[model samples]
Target: MKKLMNFKGLLLSGMMMLGMTAFAQDGASTTENYDQGFRLGFGLNGGVTTGDYFNFALGGDVRLQYDLSQRTSLTLTTGYTHLFGEDNVPDLGYIPAKAGFKAFVWGDRFYVLGEAGAGFAVTNDYNETTFLWAPGIGYANDVIDLSLRYEGANDFKTDQVALRIAYGFKL
Candidate 1:
C-alpha cells in the first residue's frame, strides 16, 4: 500500500510541474504557430523613382523563405517589374531574382530584410544586364506576409529607384 501511494504521488507531482511550466511559457511566447512550419509570400508595390530617369512603376514579387533559426530566415525572391512614364525614358519590364538575409524583429510578426544581386532586363533594344539592391520592411500574421521595398539598379551607366509592395503566403 505504501509503494502504491508513492507512485500516485509521483504521478501527481509530475502533472503539476508540467502545468506550471506551461503557464510560465505561455506569457513569453512570440509565435504561437512556430510549429506550423515553412513560409512563402508575394506582394505588389507602386512607387515613384528618383535617379538617372524619374518614373512611376509597379511591381509584383514572390518570395520563398525558410526559417534558419527561430526568428532568422533566408529568402529567395523574384519580381516582375514594369516602369513606364513619359519622363522616365527607358520604359522597362524585367524579371529580377534576389537571395538575401532576413530577420524578424518583433517576434515572428515583424521583419527587416535586404538583398544584393544581379538581374537581366527584357527590352526592345536588347536584354540588359543590371546589378540590383533591395531593402525592405515587413509584417506578418499567420499564413500571410506583406512588405514595402525600395529597389535600386545600375543598368550600364544609369541608376534608378522604385518602390514596391508585396504580399506572401506561407506554404
Candidate 2:
C-alpha cells in the first residue's frame, strides 16, 4: 500500500517534469526553426528470459519522445510484459512505466538507449512492485525502428532480453 503510493507519486512527479520541460522548449522555439518537434512510437517485442521462474516473455510498448537536440531525445515508455512460467509455477505479469534518454552514436540512425523506472507486477497470490531498467542499442528511421534490449527488475523473480520492432511516424 505504502510502496504503491510512493510509486504513484514518483510517476506523477516525473510526468510533471517532462511536461514542464516540453512547455519550456516550446516557448523558447519558433515553429519555423523545427521540422517536427516530437514523435510518438509504438513497438512490439518478444524474447526469452533467463531467471528463476520463467524463460519466455513477450511485451509491447508505446513511447513518447521529444527531441532535445539533433542527436539526442527524451523518451518515456509504458508497456505490458507477460512471463511464462515453468512447471508448477504460476505465470507472472508486469506493467512497466519508464523514462530515459536515447542518443544517436553513429548518426541520426543508430542510437544507444537507457531507461529506469518501475514495474507493477501481478502475481497469483499477491501484487508487487519493483524497480525496472533497460539498456540497449537501436536503429531508427522514419518508418521503422529496431532495437535489442536487456530488461530487468529488482525485487522481481525474472528478467528478459528482448528484440523490439516498431513503426514510427511524425506527429
Candidate 3:
C-alpha cells in the first residue's frame, strides 16, 4: 500500500540519518565515551488507553540515543503499538516514528524527555497518518531503562499513559 511504502521510506531515511550521525562523531579510540556517545535499546511497553474504545495498549520499540554531554542526549525511536478494543470493537494499531530529546534532571538516574513525529495507523480506520507527541520522565542505568510517558495521536484521536521497560547497551 502507498501508506506502507511511505512509512518504510521514512523509517529507512531516519536510520540512515542516525548512521551518518554515528560516523560524524569524533572518532575516539575508547568506547568509554558510550557514557557520552551512542547507545541502543529494545523496550517493551504496556499501559492503559485514555479513550473508552480501547482498554489496554501494548508495544515494542527500538531506541537509538546519542549523548551530547553528560546530562543531555538526542534520540530516534520507532515502534509498533496495538490498542485492544472494548467488546465488539475492532482493535487498532499504529507505528510510531519519533525524534526526541532527553536531559537528566537528577544525577545519572532520572531524566525528562519529549518527542514529536507521526503515527501511522495500521488499520486505516482512522487517517493513515497522524501527528503524534509524547512527554515523560524516566530512570536509566547502565543496563536497565524505565520510563512512564503520555503519548497522543491527533487524527487517530487516541492517547495512552504507558510504561516502558528496556535493556540498553553501548555500541
- What lDDT does each candidate get? 0.64, 0.77, 0.80
Error of 1 at 84 (Å): 1.4
Scored against the true structure, residue 151 in model 1 reaches a CA lDDT of 64
Return the top candidate by lDDT.
3
RMSD of each: 19.0, 8.6, 10.2
Instruction: Write model 3 residue lDDT over 39-71, tens digit each, in one string.
Output: 999999999876668889999999999988766
Candidate 3: residue pairs that collide: none
lDDT per residue for candidate 1 within 1-171, as digits (tens), equals 465447435644643453344334335555556653467777776776554454667778887888766566788888777766456366777788889877666555767777778777786564887887776667777665666655667673333334444555557
Tens-digit lDDT track of model 2 for 1-171: 465447445644654453344333323324445554688899999988757688798889998988877667889999888888899888888889999988766646877777899999876763889999777778999889999877777677666778999988778
Error of 1 at 67 (Å): 1.1
Rank ordering of all candidates by lDDT, starting from the highest = 3, 2, 1
Better of 1 and 2 by TM-score: 2
User: Which scores higher on lDDT, 1 or 3?
Assistant: 3
